[model samples]
Target: MPTSSRPAAFATAALTAGLALWTSGAPSVVYPVYGREWSLPPALTTVVFGTYPVTLLVVLGLFGGISDRIGRRAAIVLGLALMAVGTLAFALAPSIGVLLVGRALTGAGVGFALSPATAALAEYARPGRGHLAGAVATASTAAGLTVALLLGGLFLDLLPDPLHLSYWPLLGAVLVVLVLALRLPSGARSSGSAVRLLRVDPSMRGVVAQGALGVAAAYGTGGVVLALGADVAVGLLGTDSPIVIGLVLALSAVTIGVTALLARRVRAGAAAPAGALVMVAGLAALVTASAAGSLPVFLVSIVLTGVGYSLLFSAGVGIAAELAPAQHRASTVSAVYFAGYAVQAVAAIGLGQLATAHGLLPAIVAGAVVLSVLALVAGAAPFVRARRAVRTATGGNPA
Candidate 1:
């Protein structure tokens, strides 16, 4: 709870949460192969993929604040252990059912790690970093996702040991991160009492509402792309290489990090609106790119969406931290993430079906529609509030 350690804590938390989200990326390199190897339908394949977040949401919602009673290191260590075990299970998975078990475990590990890791970051942040903490966390998560997909592609394409190699390497890396997390100085910041569900404060209501949509915008697009983008590039866009898939997906994360850098320079309120505008533009670009089969436009659209996604996520996190009680910060952040995963799970299943029937374009259209409508509307809500604040400050309505 010192003044100088917050950023480190934020980074550490992001790394830890990345470990969990990274597992979701576990299926990336071999989605088609995995589906074929397991004899799953496109819909079922997406569900197999969706299992992680489904279990993740359940575990996080149920046990989000347990670290408040125990400690940050304990939650992280436990989560990492669970993730490792899940990977090992994945290594030996002979059936899709077994894969779900592993994914479920991975989800649970994420569930356990996410909230506490975030809270520990706040407790440990440096002076005056309250604004940028969320950006750092969300950006790290995005970066981890990008790396996971790339690595998954590498192992699948280059290595003979598809089952053993892709995730096992990551398992080793998780152990290394676990060792580093052990060194972080999160001395029991939680109150000395039994862990219980913390109530949401009134100030958090608006942020939660925005976060629910913002999270959906970022992650929903992620699900849609990961599920269908490569194939669209191949079947629809007339390409046969995995490199295109990796590059397109990976570019979004790069854009997310870049936008995070941009957000750090401005106030969260300003960034929030800009993020929504950028998201709408991105959605438009995505549609145009897909419709015209323009790879350049596709890449450009992803970049725009990534910027908006990162900014929206950062703004939501800042607002949650500002509004939530110190003790309940972890729960609040996880709750926002909960909405994100919920959107992802639904998008994967529903969009998979849509992709099955009408092709991937419809699902992609649905995502753009939802994100453009929700994030833009919420982003505009503040302009009115900002104008009212200005009027009040001047003691008269401006002409």
Candidate 2:
């Protein structure tokens, strides 16, 4: 690729990857409205919410390495086209069934674009700036998510068709990305069966395990907060404004973007484990604040959670990118996200059901407790591995 084209290619790929989250995040702002308009339960709202991740996981598992075979730009363009269709589906949704299908299509678009776009960015980056590419990809995801929440909420508050009106801008943006995708340099092609490529390398199993756990903890907690956090926020803030809920939910994405940019230099090993621990602390605080209905503390907790999410996800992506062979980079990254999104899919519906059956407080607290514990366990794994390495280096001696 020419030097001049590199920047444009990277930006397009990054934004393409971002639409994955943008499509998902936009619906979150309208979940409450869906509940009222349809007279549906929390679990139904969650089902619509959960469908996206499930579709993402399916696409990633089956076609994760398709870009490695055909071309990165092709895969991304295809994904963007699918997302545009999904946006249209959401805009025209006449029933809950249609909304669920729209969410699934959106997830499929994300799954198609996410890993390949990230790999494309890494490949197109200037030498020695690979890490920066990874950070930008992560940050782009956060940016898309933040924009979706803010705009969705704003349109919902100000527009007539709260649900359909919010998706118009998203549809236009996806079309723009499609045009940009055509201009992006086609990544080098290689011969390989996507099935074989989709298989995770045994040597990378340990780190992949740790990354999976960390990502699961981070994304699972995020699913709960974004899907149900609006209800919790209303209780704490004593307001039903979608903008307030969106802003509150947006703290997570904003922090993720800012923190990813700032922490680009940090090593993945240090960042991942430490981030997991901090996430645990943040989740604990969130549970407490939600239970007590304290707005200030809730804000503080979300900030912490946001920061922690940024660190964990960025580090996790960095670790996967570092470990995977260049040939399998897209597949490895897809696998990592497959694990993460699968967890989110399960957590969203499970927590939503809990909220509907018990109440938001108990459900939120339970989710926090589970995520905190998962993070703690994930955080301990790196130390344990380091200790075992030390013993081997010292020939069975503790020192």
Candidate 3:
């Protein structure tokens, strides 16, 4: 690749990253509409949401390192093509079954594309500034999420074909990104077992665990927000307008992008613990908001969650970048995301069932407890390791 082309490649890669989230979230605002039109239960709606991550988990496990062997450009193009197909499915879907299929295809597409795009960001980063790739990746995904919520809401509120119109634009965006992906440099391919590429070294296992936990905490919170935030907003705001719901929910994504840029200078080790603490606070606020049906508190919770998500996600990416072998970078990043999405799948589906069986408030309280514990554990892991190291150095004596 020419030096001149690197910048374009970087931008294209970022766009691909953005498209992955944009595609995943495109259906979020329409989920409630599906329920109303189809007379579906809350559990069924959440199943549709959870379907994406469930399929993504399978793809990530099997093909997470495919880009390393097939070339980044090839992997990305294939992923985007699948995304376009999935988006089209959503646009034409008239039944819940079709929607599930669409969600699955979109999940598979993201599983294939996101890790590779993230690795490509580092590959194209300027020398000595590789860290910026993680921040840029975070900001780009946040931007995508923001657009999905904001525009999906707008289309749902103002357009005649609320269910289908939002997805047509998303499909077009996927095709456009697919074109840009084709122009990206076809970097050299290597031969390796995908499973072998995903294996973490014994020495790096602890760091990998911490990174994965932090990412899981972020994704878990985000899953709740995406899965149930709209209903929560409607309850609190006393409005059924999709546009208002979207604007209110989009606050989290807006804060995520802004915080990633502002906190780019923060070190991963520091950011991980700090983000965990903030996430705990956010979860508490969320629980309070649900109990009181307070819109202002809900707003605060959304902003806090977004800030926490940015910190944790960027830090996880930073850790993966710093520790990954050049040959297996994509696989390493995928492994981190795999953990995150697994938690997200569980949270979305489980919370939905809880909400359906009990009530939204109880479900929110339960989710907050689980997420808070996860965040606290992620925050404490680094310190625990540091203390262990100190003890070992002192021959098991107290400091």
- Between candidates 2 and 3, name the one with more favorable TM-score: 3
Displacement of the residue 167 alpha carbon in candidate 3, Å: 1.2
Question: What's the lDDT for all of these models?
Answer: 0.72, 0.81, 0.85
Against the true structure, whose lDDT is highest? 3
- What would you estimate as the lDDT of candidate 3? 0.85
| lDDT, candidate 3, 1-399, per-residue tens | 233288888999899999998998888778878999889997798688778888899898889888888889988988999899999999999899999999999999998899989989888887777777778889999999989989998998789988998898889989988888888888768987644435565666666687788889889999898767877988888997878888887889999999999998887868878988899899899989988888889999999999889988888887786667767777788888889989988897789778888999888899999998998887777787678778888999965
Task: Select the stronger candidate by lDDT from 1 and 2.
Answer: 2
Model 3 spans with C-alpha error above 4 angstroms: 1-4, 38-47, 193-198, 384-399
- Stretches of candidate 1 off by over 4 Å are 1-10, 41-44, 187-199, 384-399
Ranking by lDDT: 3, 2, 1
Residue 234 error, candidate 2, Å: 0.4
Per-candidate RMSD vs. true structure? 3.4, 2.6, 2.5
Clashes per prediction?
4, 0, 0
Question: Candidate 1 lDDT, tens digit per residue, 292-383?
Answer: 88888887887888888888777766666555666667668777778878877777677777777897777678777976887786576456
- The clash tally of candidate 3 reads 0
> What C-alpha lDDT does candidate 1 achieve relative to the native structure?
0.72
